[model samples]
Target: IGVGTCIMILSLLVEAYGGYLLTHPPFSVPYYYVLIVTEESLEMIGTSCVVGGILYAMRRVSKERLKFS
Candidate 1:
């Protein structure tokens, strides 16, 4: 869970920065396209991490029969 959370957070930071750059791009046309691709890829990775983390937590809780109020 910790590892997944950390990865997602880092990816989010990358996405935010990437979006800002896309809006105010300082790179040339080719690099700008590259940035767009990278940004989308990172977002996908982040979403995957979050989903994985949720699944892991659910599995652990079920295995331990833990309940939250």
Candidate 2:
């Protein structure tokens, strides 16, 4: 969980950096590549989060038969 949180923070930072590069000057080749990769990473993060949420909901719903007393 801690590592996932760290990755989430880094992902947001990358997104912001990419946004800044897109709006500013000096749009070099390296920056363009960074922006592309970061964008892909952000998409993957979003997809994973949605999938995780769905799986969590399914797990909770399926656990109705469990008696943990």
Candidate 3:
């Protein structure tokens, strides 16, 4: 649970950074690639975390049920 929450927070941070990069391009290089990559990575991370959390919770519930029987 804690790890999932942490991942979500990190994803939010990445998204914010990506938005900033889009608005304010870097001096040396254009930030379009950086922004796109960051956005996609954040989305992937968020989705993975959500799916992983759901799987973990389901497994925990199944284990508890088996223990009762």
Best by TM-score: 1
What does candidate 2's lDDT look like per residue over 1-69, in tens digits? 344455667777777887788788877878678777986786677667767777887888889767577
Model 2: lDDT equals 0.73
Candidate 3, residue 5: the lDDT equals 65
CA lDDT, every model vs. true structure: 0.71, 0.73, 0.71
Cα shift from native, residue 18, model 3 (Å): 7.2
Which structure is stronger by TM-score: 2 or 3?
Answer: 3
Relative to the unseen true structure, what is the C-alpha lDDT of residue 34 in candidate 1, on a scale of 0 to 100? 72
- Compared with the true structure, what per-residue lDDT tens digits does model 1 show for residues 1-69? 565566667767766766676688474777657766775676677678778889988898897886655
Pairs of residues at least 3 apart in sequence or in different chains that clash in candidate 1: none
**Model 3: ten consecutive residues of lowest lDDT:** 25-34
Q: Which stretches of candidate 3 lie over 4 Å from their true place?
A: 1-29
- Alpha-carbon TM-score of each model against the true structure: 0.62, 0.55, 0.57
